[model samples]
Target: MRLAWKRWIFSLLAACTILSLHAEDEADLEQPDDVPWEEVKSTLPAYPEAGEWLPFFVTSATTNTFYIDAKSLEGTKDGVMHYTLKVVSENGAVNVTREGMRCSTREQKLYAIGDDRSKTWREPRNNQWVFFKKWAINRQLNVLYDDFFCPGRIIVYNVNDAIRALRSGVPVSGKSSRD
Candidate 1:
């Protein structure tokens, strides 16, 4: 009898919890959708100057930084935002520049490391595992930043995981963070 009563109580509690969560989701959905662009910009940190690197996202392989030399913002009639960011990197003696997008959708365009003619990336030592790591990082960032109501200025890689990964070292080029 006690076990049956306890089970009934547990089921009731679970149902109540689920209903509460559903109510909260409905409340959020019903809220006004007019997010002021100025307010959003105000929430973000100050833009990094030409020479400074801003923390875009990080991975086990590289602490990816955005040297946004220039940025242009535009808003579509449907309210989608577009950002054209000019990124410059100086790895060794080679100076490479590419135009990347930080936009409202997953249609991101990432350029090759070298110039248009060369189309090659001379990756540094201890950094061959960057592209895959970066792809995953950007994928998650898209899910977060693409949301119009997402209240986040930046996405950060877990510090503990980063330290562990660094200590363990790279495990071949295409290996993911989970591996």
Candidate 2:
């Protein structure tokens, strides 16, 4: 009986150790490959607040710049954070307007550095703007350096994902189909 108990304890300890190591490996895989982790951390801008406008441009195409006015941050509820945003083009034209864009905390942490604030903005594509939201600025840096864009053109990464979700017909909080 004593020996059986000892074997059980040893097995439990070994399993726990293996699980811990696996988690550590998964975390390391999440880091971006193009930029050094430290550089990515140093380059991020401060988190935006209501009424602040942030100018962002894709590095590969410098002239294609846009602005996002931080309209509001409706606090997190049920593990998801809600945001309101206004995306404008360089010529002072409003491209896309979003109300209560939903971002889950899990997605926020994956691409963000520091406190992993959810970052969502619009990017231009095919002569129109598309919504793209990543967790952090570091993710943006990685995308700017590695992703493909047409000459003198800027586009968002996987805009279709947002479109697909929208087409699914799920309504955002505080808004209804009747509205």
Candidate 3:
């Protein structure tokens, strides 16, 4: 009798927890269809002027996901203005925290890296695995200075993993994530 009663209680508790989580998810998804663009325009930090090229962006790739999943940067707007960000998982498995940089030749088009071409980037600096993207730094500055021979950004994923994910196509890309 005790085992049966305990099982019933546990099941009931589990169901309640799941319902609560679902409710929270629904609440998070309340924004309009254009919310992504709105957030990008309003929340994105302004670039500090660089000399020749315009500094476009210097942030973690987690920016998009964090904006979508959490609706805010770590529950605060200030955290959004960062070159580094973290991802927290419910199970804590594939959590990510990395910084990225992207620079642009035009001030109005600084945010075109990854999603666009023509942006100037620095050669990937592989200093014992802690690489840096000069494009990102350029975006946050008032100059268009970079070492072209080393402008390959050290992407967040390894070559194999990147190939696999890229093969997964638009799903891995945020272009389809909003939907």
lDDT of 1 by residue, 1-179 (tens): 99779768876775565455422122332214466322122112223233232223332233233322223233333322323232334353434433223332223333323332354343333411121112243433332232221222121223233223223442212243333
lDDT of 3 by residue, 19-97 (tens): 5642213233222344342222332322212212211222222222221111111112211111222223335432222
Best by TM-score: 1
Q: Say which prediction, candidate 1 or candidate 2, comes out ahead on TM-score.
A: 1
Model 3 Cα displacement at 87 (Å)?
Answer: 1.4
TM-score of 1: 0.27
Model 1: how far is 24 from its true place, Å? Answer: 21
* All candidates: TM-score: 0.27, 0.26, 0.17
- Cα lDDT computed for each candidate against the true fold: 0.31, 0.31, 0.25
Segments in model 2 whose C-alpha atoms lie over 4 Å from true places: 1-50, 62-64, 99-179
lDDT of 1 at 139: 38
By TM-score: ranked, best first: 1, 2, 3
- lDDT tens digits by residue: candidate 2, 41-90: 11223344344444443332222444333332233322222332334445
